[model samples]
Target: MRRGALRPFRSFLPGPRSMFYTTDGPHGLPHNPFMAVMVPRPIGWISSVDAAGNRNLAPFSVFNGMPCDPPVVFFGPSGQHKEGGPKDSLRNIEETGEFVCNIATWETREAMNASSALVARDVDEFELSGLTPLPSTLVKPARVAESPVHFECVHLQTVHLPSKLAGVSALVIGQVVGIHIDEGILTDGIVDMKKFRPIARLGSSDYTVVDTIFSMIRPG
Candidate 1:
């Protein structure tokens, strides 16, 4: 291609290199460099209502859903503390037993990150984070208008894990009630990641974009 400009190393480069490890240590490797270098994590902009009917929002990367009979999704919240306050999203979901998962995109990355702040329970993350709260047709909680996809869900169960030497962790499972997708993102009756440009979390303070895509067809 471009005249002798160090032809991008072909076979010399390894194929998508990564190192996987688990954290079972005290404090789980304080400030894990894993996420930052991991580069991009899918964000679950969770919305929930407190027992008092107050709303809360927060982002978590330990999130994914399964296509079981009723469609179930789950998220993990670390029992970490900042200024000795409870996580607003986890607390609200525990209190209200309901939440909405909104898929974050590049357009809404800043707003999603804002909701990650350690705000008071009563503080409305939508307002504080300057994110638009769109009413959910099938769920009590509202969805983030800036998000490209939204899944209205009801809490099914929570698996509490022992903290041992560190704070506790919780696995929250939610049953999907409704799904919503942006019209612009739907092309040829399919949602494209390139158009979605979904954002993901990396360990620490790093993040990544998700437009790069490829496909492989498995033998039927």
Candidate 2:
């Protein structure tokens, strides 16, 4: 296939009439299709420690690398937790101003899901998820031992998104001060996706693995 080619899948069943609704109102569907359409989002397996030395780990699907220079990344935590407050990972980063973004992979999918459980602030998610905590060189928050890649970041700022609801969503931006990559995943000094097999978040409870890959050179 050519680069950026569109491939439409035709269905024999009658499709629903196209409808539009403002985000402020209900989507008018059984389930919101917004997230569903934005598929294969990279999972930010964030780990952080609070001021009181409590460790927290959680996965945020709204995460991505901001830019290459200075190495920046961000993760958005939407809505309120069951405890009626920001998530532990967000709260800890707010307090300590440090975090580790561990890459999630197919091998650690179960542990990654386990870490997302809503637990008390004092609970150690590393232990709960049965994942080893690897000490970070520059950050207080430990990296997931099972993860092939880790980015030690310093909190830059948190941008709060406008919300009509009582609770607010925030984008936590961080400058990656250090990076760790497992040599095993590198082929000829380049990171190999086939070996890494990183997992991504889909809509609802679904997830996807990087099983297939293709490359294209940018047009001059």
Candidate 3:
């Protein structure tokens, strides 16, 4: 087989006619396909601390890295909290201006999902998730000890987007101030991501593991 070539499956079924719908109205599917269509999104396992040092942890699928020169990252919080305020991760970052992005992996997948539960403002999700919190080098928010990689970031700014609900959605951006990488995931001083096996998010109670990897150099 040629590299980067697609192989046909015996049981493959051809999809029907493409269905299109406007955002103004429903698509008529039982569940929204927007998130599903955006497959294998990086899971932002964010950790932050409040003014009073109340730590918070949460997972958001709407997250990704942006602009490598400055090393920036962003995550989206779609709705208001259950108690009618910003979610703990957003609220804490707003208060402290610091957060840590812990890489979620198959090893800690269950604990990552557990931390996403709606909890009180005073709740410590690290404790709730049964994950050990290690003091960060440049931030007050603790890092997930088991995670192979961590990005300690300082909140740059937050942009509020219009939401259908009473409150607005938040797009939180951060500048990476510090980074940690486990040497075990490195090969010849380069990141061997297959060994890292970061877990990614999908729609409707689904998740994917990034164990398979390939690389291509850009044309000069």
Candidate 4:
């Protein structure tokens, strides 16, 4: 099958009204269809330095980058930590005021997923994923040395959102202070995404990659 192609979908909704449904009540599916319905979501492989200056890494599917002038990125942890309170990434970023958003690619997808495992607060995810942590230029948080691109950012603010479960669900907005890109992925000064092959989250237990390319110019 071609890259980004979708399989035939069979819906649980009945009759012609199937197209319309409300999320306020259960749709009678095996799993909650919220995340999957959103299609491919950007993955932010975030790294931060703890109080001990130890590195922590985690993958957030609910992450995105804004095309603002100065550039900005946001990510959030959906649940409480295994040890309690916020996740290490949030705690460390709030305390240290710095973090690095590593671009997740097909090459490091396995390692990125491995880092998402819920473990103790003191656990080092870089070691858990068997990836090297490189020092960032402007941030105390380490960068994934193997990643093709990275955005070093500082905490701007965090807005708490309603959560259906225990603990806080917050959206953390960060200001991008620095960026690092591997020149090898560039083609004649243009950043070739086909070579980058960044990965994204697609439904539960599934992921997709930017392995294909197409173009569409805006109508003038």
Candidate 5:
């Protein structure tokens, strides 16, 4: 298959139905399906430090890579916390312009969930979750020691999205200045998914793990 080539997907299911609704309108469902529809999103276990040098760790489901030439990635924090402010991760990134993106895996799921608790600005999630923090070479924030992969990033900018709700959401974009990968997960020089065993977010409190692998060559 050539680049930009189209592949037909044949489905035996019924044809699509009109179930779309405006963002401002109600979907008539018990829970919004937006997050569920974007199933299995990569979790960015973000670590940062405040001006006072207090470390902060949090997991953002709305996170992913943005570019490759400069190796960029981003995580978005939506809504204000119970403290009535932006998340500590976002605030710390703004304060110091540095952060580390740690890849969350099945083994660290519990710790990840614990770190997501809305704690105070001075609180360190590493200690709260009982996870070890490894010093980063290129950033002030420490990387999750249990995580197999880490991206030491320098904050580039934050884009705030207009929202109808009281609180706004922002995307924190950063340039990956350094990366650490565990050699144990490498298979023939490539990171093996089976060994990595990464976990991802789903709707509500649901999560899924990556235990299976398959590949297909792109058409050229």
Candidate 6:
């Protein structure tokens, strides 16, 4: 049955439409579904390495670039996995103080998703995901060769949010030391978003493509 077709019969008693946009706590039917419906969040294909030289890669929707003089980007890693403690990827970054954020495209979607597993700290996601790694000129961590854009970053800060949806969540901020854009993607010295065709996180088992785009100009 179509989801929309069956919607009118079922009613939401305590939802955004009824609560005037203010709801407390993180339980009940009013939590996850609400955030997921906000839809089409950009994916951050984060890559990091641990002190023992183990590599980690994963995808996250809680990612955004901070527009500052030198450029900074941020991604939030769940404090713990569904099974246990913090994911090794974020922990590795915390230990090494460096990471690489790769932009995921339709071409690398499968590989990006493959790395999102609950693996041990010694395991290498690059090997498990079957993606080629290119040596980074500026950072010790390697960049995914298939990705068109890569941001080599040094860890800046982490905000621990203990009472989030999960018992563990950390907002990691990084300063961009180097940026690499594939030559094929460069046009008139600008990186085209349309050409990127980046995949975005929607919800559980749902994703969106970058096909329809619009622009706006801020008033002076």
lDDT of each: 0.81, 0.91, 0.90, 0.89, 0.90, 0.83
In model 5, the runs with Cα more than 4 Å from the true position are 1-18
- Model 2, 1-220: lDDT tens digits are 7887978887766458666778878886766689988988999999999998778899989999977789999999877767788878778899999999999999999999999887877789999999999999998999999999999999999999887656658889999999999999999999999999999988878899999999889979
In candidate 6, what are the lDDT values of residues 17-96, reduced to their tens digit?
65333346534553477657767788999988878777778888889897898999998887575557678767788899
Q: Taking the tens digit of each residue's C-alpha lDDT, what string does model 4 give over 1-220?
A: 7887988798676887655548666667776688888879989999998878988999999999898978999997768888889888888888988899999999998899899998887789999999998888987888999999999999999889986779879999999999999998999999999899999988868899998889988979
Candidate 4 runs further than 4 Å off: 1-21
TM-score of 3: 0.90
RMSD of each: 5.6, 3.8, 3.6, 5.3, 3.8, 7.2
Instruction: Determine which window of 10 residues in candidate 2 has minimal summed lDDT.
Output: 11-20
Tell me which of candidates 1 and 2 scores higher on TM-score.
2
Candidate 3 CA-lDDT value: 0.90
Q: Estimate each model's TM-score.
A: 0.81, 0.90, 0.90, 0.90, 0.91, 0.82
**TM-score preference between candidates 2 and 5, better one:** 5
Model 6 quality (TM-score): 0.82
What are the clashing pairs of model 2?
Answer: none
Pull out the clashing pairs in model 6.
79-168
List residue ranges in candidate 1 displaced over 4 A. 1-40, 80-86, 164-167
Off by over 4 Å in 6: 1-31, 81-84, 164-167
Q: Taking the tens digit of each residue's C-alpha lDDT, what string does model 3 give over 1-220?
A: 9997989677644567768789879899977799888988999899998899988899989999986887999999877778887777888888889999999999999999999998777789999999999999999999999999999999999999877766559899999999999999999999887788999988889999987888889979
Tens digits of lDDT, candidate 1, 21-133: 55664334568665565555567889988787778888889888899888998988886555454576677777777899999888888888888887656689999989888
